[model samples]
Target: MIALLPLAVILPMIGAGVTMVASRRPRVQRALSVTALAAQLAVALIMLVVVDDRGPMVMHIGGWSAPFGITLVADRLAAFMLVVSTIVTLAVLIYSISQGRDDEEEDGTNSETPTSIFHPTFLILATGVSNAFLAGDLFNLFVSFEILLTASYVLLTLGGTTERLRAGAPYIVVSLLSSLIFLSGVAMVYAATGTVNLADLATKIDSVPPGIKATIAAILLTAFGVKAAVFPMSAWLPDSYPTAPAPVTAVFAGLLTKVGVYAIIRVQTLLFPGMFTTVLMVAAGATMLVGILGAIVQPGIKRMLSFTLVSHIGYMLFGVAIGSEAGVAAAIYYVAHHILVQTALFLGAGLIERVAGSTVLARLGGLAAAAPVLAVLFFIPAMNLAGVPPFSGFLGKVGLFEAALEGSTGAAQVLPLVIVCLGTLTSLLTLYAIVRVWGRAFWRPVPQAGEEHPPTGPLDPRGDHPMTTQYTESRRRAREAARRRMAAAEAARLPLGMVGATTAVVTVGLVLTVGAGPIYGLAERAAGNLMDQQTYVRAVMDTPADGAADLLIDPPGLSPAEPTAQDPGGTG
Candidate 1:
């Protein structure tokens, strides 16, 4: 079962090449991408069940063992993230295929044209995301980042349109700069600790001088903060995200920043426990306020959603900043919830654009009556994203608030409480932003030419013209056919493939709401595993009791203990 870990990474990589070869046959490419993701999702489920039943699973490539070879570990957190991400990728693949089919029809192109590379690049992106979650060492994590970044470069600039190029340029520059910083941090860690393996670092990092430890933490945090879109480092996300195609934006938004958050969780819990709590809290509050404010001001749906996405990340960071087992658990649950909800919202935004011929709130109207299904699809996830009651979003935030109140004390308590207030305020503001879009874009009547205001005329439930008597019965069929063709061309009525895929993902988000109990229990266990770094170290290193005692390196001022039979790996 541990061997299945690498297959999660390898299968998609292989499929990427296969997809490229089948690119000329769009149907073949689509089949390969979907099959690969389905298989990956199945493997992820197996890993989740196995890891939950047993414990963290580790595999060393070629049996080289420990820090000396490539290592893949699937703990509950990694397994859960992999499963959710694979689901999102699969849904997005179907959505992209639908878009591609529309493009092919519009251009009158045959399947053999090789006009798009969406499938191949998409698979490569999936490979990168899976690899990152499973990475057991720092260098491999860097490699995962590079792999995803390379794939994203292609995906972001897919059509080579002027807007895409402009968006892709800033994204590439920021990503490259962050990569350089990450590599430098990795080098510094290796230099100080003599190992880039996370398990090894969990032990060795404590022995480093306090100043050096702080430097390394700062460097790594800065690198990840940029990636995670934390406050003051999140300028790149809103602009870069909204310019890409719907599926691209959805996947990037859903998975990419969460990976950074995952890394931060690993770093803070496993490598440097209880460090920089105040700084994290401060950043968390600012990210929430700043991001939501940006969201509130946006006129376009994608840009507004992108800003809200950044804002909600602050909620995850709030959990991290609390620095407790409960906090970590809540953050993990929130990450999963956000991934589903955000992806659904973006996909829903795509539907809106299809119906209105734009995402601009001012240009859109009457979707509630004209496209009731789309309105429902958009409304559920929109409310979910806004942290509406009885939804996973609300539950996740409540968990974080509970954890914060439970964990904080004295002056520390004040900031966490302040953040709690701000978080609540942000939620209300999010609801306002989402509702503003819904009210203006869906409920309001469509504005007529030369009309100073939208007509308050009653809407027909069947979406008939209010003045139906004006059309002669003889002309009705021809008028209806013309309207049908126009609707199809404009995507006023969405394709089943697109709507079905979006609905599938939205259902998954609802599952998070319905299954929050067992899901959060799994998160609690994962958080415990994260806090007990020794279990992970032992799982990876396979050290004897005596060797484990020697490996134990507690932070300065703390005494190390001998390893017992039950605790072969000493406390990290």
Candidate 2:
């Protein structure tokens, strides 16, 4: 079973090479990509089952042993993330293929178009995401980020339109800055402890001075916060994500930020336990309030959803801030829930664009009557995202709130309690924001000729509100252009494959809600394993301390506590 660990990371990379080689054959590339993702999902599920039955699984590359050779570890958290992420990537791939087919059919374009690059880059992206989850060392995790970021740059700028290039430029600059910080942090960790292995660092971090440890933690957290789009550092997300192709945007919004959140979870829990609770809690409250406020004022669907995405991340950070077993478990559950629901919503938004020819609320109307199926698809996920009752979103948030209340006491609990109230307010505001979109874009009657659609005014981020005539006129012209586009799109037929992929994603979101009980149970176990950090350290180092061998069987010829050549005190 240990051998299977590398396969999950390697198979997608192989698939990427094959797809690139077969770039001229669209059918072959599509088939190969789908097969690769399917196999990846299977491997992930098998790993999940194995890890659940047994414990964490570890693989040492090139027989060099831990702290020297590369290592891959799959605990319950890694396995679960792998399965969920693979499912999302596969769905998005199908949607993208359908989209490409539709574009070629409509435009009469040749096979050599930019769409040819999508499959290989997407596969490479999946491989990077898998590698990040399974990586056992800080340097390896940095490599994974670089892999995904390189692919993402291509995906973001695939069309090379002025808008996409503009968005991609800022995204690239921000990502590179974050990577630099991550690399610097890795170097510092190595210089301080003489080992980059996460398990080794876990044991050695305590010996470092408190000030240096705090500085390292701050640098690392800042880098990850930029990636995760936490408040004060999240202004880039809404502007950057809305310009990409719908499929690209969907996967980016769904999977990318969560990877950062996952890193924060691992770093906080494993590397620096109980270090910065107050700071995280304060950030959580600000993220929730600011994000929802931004969402409330956006006029575009994708931008609004993007802000909501940032807002809901606060919920996960809130869980991490609590720093308890239940808190971490709730966070794990919420992360899984958010990934599915956000992907579904974005895919549904794509379908809406296909039918309405625009995502601006002012230009879209009567969708409930013209495209009831698309409306249903959009409505379910929108409600789920807003934390509607009996949905996974609600359950996840409830779990987090409960955990926050239970995990702290007295004055230590005051901030979390305040954040909980603020979270509830954020939830209500989220519902209002989505419902506003639905009411204007779906429930309202289509505007007649010369009806003069009402203006909602510019989305003021600073709360200064005076509507300018020039701004209103610009909005009117945009709406008129959108109307013309919608008129043209009305003649085109919607693709069944695209709709089917969207429907499947939405159904998966529903499944999360229905299976919340069993899923949350799994999250609890994953969190339990995370809190018992010694178990992970032992598994990776092959050192079972004092009868710990009975809990998990290590591979043969793997010596326990082998000292590294670089640092005599470093534990393998």
Candidate 3:
């Protein structure tokens, strides 16, 4: 099983190559991609069970030991993240496959030209995600980010439509900037501690000056904050994501930002414990408020969901800010929950777009009467995201609030209290946004031309208000556009594969609710190990020289403070 740890990343890479070779055969490519992700998910689930019961496992690469060779460590947190992430990628892949086949069948040709790259690039992206989850060193983590971000560029601009290209340009620029920042931070980290291995740094970083340590931490956090789409840094996301293909948008919404959160959690817990609590708390509140505020005003489902996506990130950031086992535990569970729910909502949005011909609230209506299954799909995740009771979202939020209130203590109770209030406000606002979308996009009558009052202005010389003339003309244009979209979409049938994949994801989200006890227990245990520096450091650095023994079974002999021959001067 320890040896199989690397396979989580390897299988996907291998599949990417194989799928690329078989691209001429679309069916073969799809089969290979699905098979690869399924295998990766199996590996991830096995690791989750193994690490939870047996403690962390460390596999040194190429027979070389840690702090020198590449390392892959799977503790409860990494394993759990891997499991959730693979589930999402797999479901999205299936959805994408169905969408592609349906499009070709509808048009009787490959309307989406150059479709060959999609499968391979998608698998590579999966590989990158898996690598990131298991990466035991800073450099490898950076490499993983590059792998995924590069693949995303291709996925985002698929078909090279002008709209997609426009969206991808800023996305590319922002991504490149974030990558540069992350790379610089990695360099600074190495310059400070002479090691990029996370476990090794966990011990060595303390010896660095306080000023330098703080600078390094802040630099890394800023880069990760950008990737996670934390407020102020998040402006690029809503514009950038909504233009991609449905599966592309769904997967990006679900997995990419969470990876940034995962990095923040790993670094904060392992390298610099309790260092930026105040900053994180303040950021969490601002992100929640700003994100939801943007959400309520959006008239489109995709954009609204995108804003809510940014807003919910605040909840996870808040959990990390609380810095307690319970707080971190709740954050972990919420990350998993949000991944599933958000993906389902985006896929559901895709369905609504297919059925109604548009996601714009004014152009969409009466979906419940036409497609009740689609309505249910969208509704479940929407309510779950808004933290409605009895759902995993609600359970996760309650856990976070309980943790915050319980941990609130002398002289600093005010911050937690204030954040709690803001979080509660954010929740209500999120619910409001969801309800507005539900009412406008689902319950209202299907929009029809000539529903508005007749113009009595320039277009109709009897009009009293000139502004009304302009408003009426714009409405006329919008209605016409909606009609065209509907006319085109009317001939397309809803693909069962797409619906089934979304249902599977939504069902998994429900499972998080039904089995919240055991899952939260896993999260709690993962958080405990995360907060304990020794568990991770020992697993990575203290292994036996022969290295045949299971890391979980044999404790490392060397102390964290001592320098190995690998670092003769302790300043590599």
The residue-by-residue lDDT of candidate 3 on 54-122, one tens digit each, is: 668888887778898888889889999999999999999998888888888878665443458998999
Each model's lDDT comes to: 0.85, 0.86, 0.88
| Residue 174 miss distance in model 3 (angstroms) | 1.3
**Model 1 agreement with the true structure over 491-566: per-residue lDDT tens digits:** 5657788899899999999998999899999899889888888868877887332222222223223334645433
Looking at model 2, the pairs that clash are none
Using all chains and alpha carbons, the TM-scores for the candidates as numbered come to: 0.88, 0.90, 0.92
Q: Could you tell me the lDDT of residue 446 within candidate 3?
A: 67
* Residue 512's lDDT in candidate 1: 88
Q: What is the C-alpha RMSD of each candidate to the true structure, in Å?
A: 7.4, 7.1, 5.5
Of the pair 1 and 2, which is ahead by TM-score? 2
Query: What value of lDDT does candidate 2 attain over all alpha carbons?
Result: 0.86
Clashes of each: 0, 0, 3
Give the top-scoring candidate (TM-score): 3
Query: For model 2, how does the per-residue alpha-carbon lDDT over 1-572 read when each residue is reduced to its tens digit?
Result: 77668999999999999999998998999999999999999999999888887678887776656787677889889999999999999999888888888888878773322656989999999999999999999999999999999999999887788988898898999999999999999999998899989888999999999999998899888888888999988988999998888898999999999999999998999998888889998999999999999999998999999999999999999989899999999999999989988998898888878777789887777788778888899999899999999899999999999998984679888898999999999999999999999998888866543344544556578653356666566667766765675565555466877788888888988888989888898899889888988978988887232212322532223344644332246354
